[model samples]
Target: MTARANTVAVGYLHALLDYARARGLALDALRAALPFDPSDRDARVPEALGAALFDRAAALLEDDALGLHVGEQVRPGHYGALGFVAMNCERLGEALDALRRYQALVIDLGGVGLKRDEQTCTLSWNPGTDGPYRQLAEFNLAGLVTFARWMAGAWAKPLRIDVMYAAPADTREHTRILGCPLRFAQACYRVVLPIDALDAPLIQPDPAMRELMQRLADQQLRALPRGDDWLTRLRAQIARRLRQPPVELDAVAAALALSSRSLQRRLQAEGLRFSALVEQVRRELAERHLADASLDLADIALLLGYSEQSAFQRAFKRWTGQTPAQWRAAHTEPRN
Candidate 1:
């Protein structure tokens, strides 16, 4: 997807603009450097603009601490409200539910969803009406984990992050910033935290305040900013189809209530082919499954719409230079 409809990146750009203004930089000057049209209120700002902003901001600043300040400006009440919600919840599950409900309010670029398995609670992202932003997605995941730790009064342990995107060439900064097990190019953007984390009581709790925050969060979710793009809408539809594997293109078109030809035409207009997008989804899922050693290769292959394990392996190798096992070994670590 073109950068314009990437909510995470756009939100980060918005945050950067605000930061520059706060630092006495001219708003017009900042706008001039960006690709977005300042005069067009409805115009979508590209994700490239956000990337450029981050790169420039990172270079201009002396340290990464400035990024935290920028994040605060981007989502002002995010951490405070999370702390309030955690303290008020009766149990860890309740707190997680509250976090799921409120996370969107902090930034509507992407929404966070929770799934509980027998061993861990997985926090995943449900891309909003906007397409995904790789960097913004990374930042959001990192920020949420850090905020959750702060709320629980446990800053010593790191949150487990699994990303759908491939691992970057440079891992030192990412590892240093996250301080947790990092798996890249996974099937989904998620964090797998031990169930025990939920039982750790909050440092502060107030039922009345938590309820009030919940009300505020609900209101915010209702008023979230939405994207106006075919790619954004199509990505959401593709995500839904992944659950019930072996999705046919025509079926997806029918689900969107558009003719198959029309769907194809629309996707083409957006510079994307439906098949390519489906492959992208499969690649993401493959990466995730490959990282988890417990998941057998055949099972992962079946889940990703591949008929044979060899086919899945070949595809995985094409996506990343290394074999799936090699990639996982390079990324995974023993749980502390």
Candidate 2:
């Protein structure tokens, strides 16, 4: 009914739950009126509940490794129908497609993308919502690599791993589990897949079974309740398109399958304006891009869709009451 019901995969919570149970944590304390059935490991829960669970677990453990441990421990089966669809696909490429297509059944936050070229394939991830769990980006990639090793081959190492976070002081652990060279604080978190891995045959490929799994996944996905928040959808579309110049109202309306007039009226009904949303999305993206040490102020400006660096500077000043460089200097961490 409410946007609060926007779903997240239960596995994220289940991981914390598993660790807590293993350490004799009073699971009952963390089980406050959660929207998902506690007994169903494969269930989807309201996003609020998932966030709450992560908060509680972090408070209890006080260790960053908790999420990393959970990621490594997530068996392919833990993903439920999504995992089933992926594992049953005929080859590594098909498996990746299944994961991308059915990922909504697991988490409503970020979408997955796969781009293949003559030499290699790249898998890019963008977090859906801003939270500590978004930092679980690392864990999510680690889990995929975990699955990659199983589906592709043990020797199916990545060409490189790019993260949005700054490089850890010691990346041996990342290299150990992720099994790849690391690039940190760049554009976003990405996995560069090896070419040989793409066409590698999956051990459990069954085309018929994959079809059956897809049908079941579709049924299950349809059964899940979706968020009724128009604002959330609008914001998501805007954010996804901010990199493109002059994100037109007509384009966004078309993406939502609505007439421009209807989209305008609906946004007005929610006490929002199309121009206001554009500003909000651009501001958020600007702040995020500025944090990446790899990107210069000019590049950040262009990424946020301004044709000129000066125009972007003017807009950034209006949004944050500081020029882009000033904001970066004040808000971003100093390099060692």
Candidate 3:
């Protein structure tokens, strides 16, 4: 896999396929396009492929809400160790916290964020630049809701739902499955709930089992082969925080749970400097956005955290010996 590649557990792929088969949809074409060994249940697949499978299955079944439906079928096994850890967590909050910490074991496409206040809490999904793929985003949000309901009770439901995309033509399935007021075209995708719900006791709260599963999950996290190294992780952190403002050393260090001095030392050990890596990430993202052929140089500059298009233009020239427009003209195909 490439440095930026993201992957998901194979179990999720199987779950989607299983849902498709149950609905009498044939899998021949899907298998041909994105083949995977059905026997390799313990393996991982590219997250892109998983998203594609969701898209293909939705098309084949003619179900716009396919991700939501497939997510409803998620069982503990689908998430691997993290699932069991959540299953044994004493409180709903504990379960979600575990998910936040160890979710990369199941999917590494983006991030899961949790925030709380006195009266309410929000769980948000921040997908990558390539996504907020409508079906995949629904799957992620629906899977969380389904897992929460299974762990807490049938009464469990989000207070409101916020989706990053425009409202679909049909929202009946969303309303039926999510059972909440829905907001669309928001800054991010979120599930909002009463804060008290976080304290609700799970149906099965086994402290001993939770501890055991947590150990296994920690081991799995340490063993993750993709982009787990310090340098790669730092680049990813820089990429994420670029648009959030104050993309400085202290901020990036805090995100990585390292002091600025320590972070600098680590980078030095890798024969790198923090500033250099940040610039590298910006250049990479600039190229990626430029490849779309829809984003103008100014938009790409802002996305890369530039205060001015001129600053980005200068940096791009430094990185690639060409102006942003010049590079785009040479590298990307013109739109029809």
- Which candidate has the top score in lDDT? 3
Q: List the residue pairs that clash in candidate 3.
A: none
C-alpha displacement of 263 in model 3, angstroms?
14
Q: Which ten contiguous residues of candidate 3 have the minimum total lDDT?
A: 265-274
lDDT of 2: 0.69
* Candidate 3 lDDT tens digits, 238-289: 9998886667999888988889998876654333456656765776688778
- lDDT order of candidates, top first: 3, 2, 1
C-alpha RMSD values across all candidates: 14.2, 16.7, 18.2
Q: TM-scores of all models? A: 0.53, 0.62, 0.67
Residues 245-278, candidate 2: write the lDDT tens digits: 6788999999888899988866543334577667
Cα TM-score of candidate 2: 0.62
TM-score of 1: 0.53
lDDT of all predictions: 0.58, 0.69, 0.77
Clashes of 1: 10
- Residue 94 lDDT in candidate 3: 70
Candidate 2 wrong stretches, greater than 4 Å: 1-6, 29-36, 40-43, 46-48, 132-135, 167-170, 228-336
Error of 3 at 132 (Å): 2.9
lDDT of 1 at 51: 54
Over 4 Å off, model 1 = 1-51, 62-92, 109-111, 126-134, 155-159, 225-336
Across 168-230, the per-residue lDDT of candidate 1 in tens digits comes to 666665666567788886545667777666566665666567657655655654455655545
Q: Higher TM-score: candidate 2 or 3?
A: 3
Give the least accurate 10-residue stretch of model 1, judged by summed lDDT. 1-10
